[model samples]
Target: MSTLPVLNNADMYHHYSDVQFRDGCSVIHEMLKPKRGESILDLGCGTGRLTMQLASLVGDSGRVVGVDPDSCRIAVANEQLKKMDDIPVTFQLGSIREALPLGPFDGIFSNYVFHWFERAERAEMMHQMYDSLKPGGRLTFVLETNQPQPNAIIRDIFRLTEPNLDEESASGMKMDVPSVWLQHCSDAGFLVELSEVFRTEKAGPNLDAILQFLKASIPNFQPIKLTDDGLHELDSRYKTGNGDEVAFSLTVLKVLARKPQES
Candidate 1:
């Protein structure tokens, strides 16, 4: 796979996580239900915020391993680890496609991460997660749903400025609906525990932040750089009102699946 769009922009991503994705932690915490003395893996753990949180739940006897594909993010994660001397959390630079050899974990926790996997690789990812877990290990996560409204809004806004941009190439992210995810889990030998779809809103980014996110996180949008005047125009057109924060709506999918014990 080509390099991730956020590979070199860890600081911006850390900021994005804090402001936009932090609120999802409550749902993740409730779903994962990590136990003390349990081994957990934080897959796609960008900058290790959630990983540290998991470590706290697991306590001194347990350990949490955080893995991500981006080196810069991993570096940031390691830096954060310095302040977490009591938490048994470690960050590794790796991709999910590797089927991570560090395994037999009691639980796996990911937040807004699975959708980053390519659609074609998702089944394999499910299998890998299954293999990485001990029997009855749980995989819990929340990610953007495969609903079209969000993507459509992005495409529509970009098209206003660049009419030539194609729909298929506008986004690098691959989100899927719950049914599709359930099928993958079943195929990988997981017993589905819970699946829910929900909606949430985040403060819409301004043009400067939007441009940074697109350039740093959206591969398809990277090549289509917006001019200064065009960006200002799009911001004027899309932003809600003067001095008001724009509302960005997202449909989210939450799942808790477990590897079935040997019969």
Candidate 2:
């Protein structure tokens, strides 16, 4: 699909991501390597599942804040935090479209959030992230990229149904090339020490599960408006390559950029 993946709305996403997002991002903890007493930011922290994990890792002396544009997501995250007796994390209903926390943080992390913006906005987001970090602070994230297999079966279904879905309309969802981000990091004064793409495949009981995951986790991944039957038909069409099982793969690009300590 040309559009970035996203849940139809925050609430629908809240329902699915509350359980799945944490498990899906299990790899990020090791990637983040959050240290005790360090200040970290979870950009686009959905429902605080990983936020709580980050909070625990930071220990009593550490600090972390989760930011998202959706108020409902922030609210849900806040509610989840309340269940805990103590946490070092906070949630804000904000976005990278605007400013971020004023900090020179030890690290900043985003899971599936960067692709939501266009290239220019992404550059702005990068500068803000670079400015928010400490001299040697790091920024790392996992986002979908159009590479090796920009397999967007969802968009194909949309095209088959709406023959007139032009490129302008389809372009709303992005499968950005990796070089775009690498350049953004450079423009934002970050030294990109690591960059790589990891391919993940998913096949499950049915298309419904995968559909919900895509709609929930991806940002603007699907176009608005479609009947239930239409979605089911789309799902069936996707399985043509895999028989009864629904199989698909997504390319996740992991980037680690560090602000120069001297600068």
Model 2 stretches astray by more than 4 angstroms: 1-8, 18-27, 97-101, 148-151, 160-162, 166-171, 213-245
- CA lDDT of every candidate: 0.72, 0.69
Residues 165-263, candidate 1, lDDT per residue (tens digit)? 554355656766778888988999998899888776555556556556655555545525566666565666557674634445668788899988887
- Runs of candidate 1 with Cα error greater than 4 angstroms are 1-6, 97-99, 150-153, 160-162, 205-207, 220-224, 227-242
Residue 121's lDDT within candidate 1 is 72
> Tens digit of lDDT per residue, candidate 2, span 1-263?
11123334566666655323653355456566889999988887867777787788889999988877667677888888888988788787676433254466788888777776665466667888888888989888887777755555545545644557653254355557888889989999999988887777655556665556656655444534556777676676667465566666667788888999972
| TM-scores of the candidates in the order shown | 0.85, 0.81
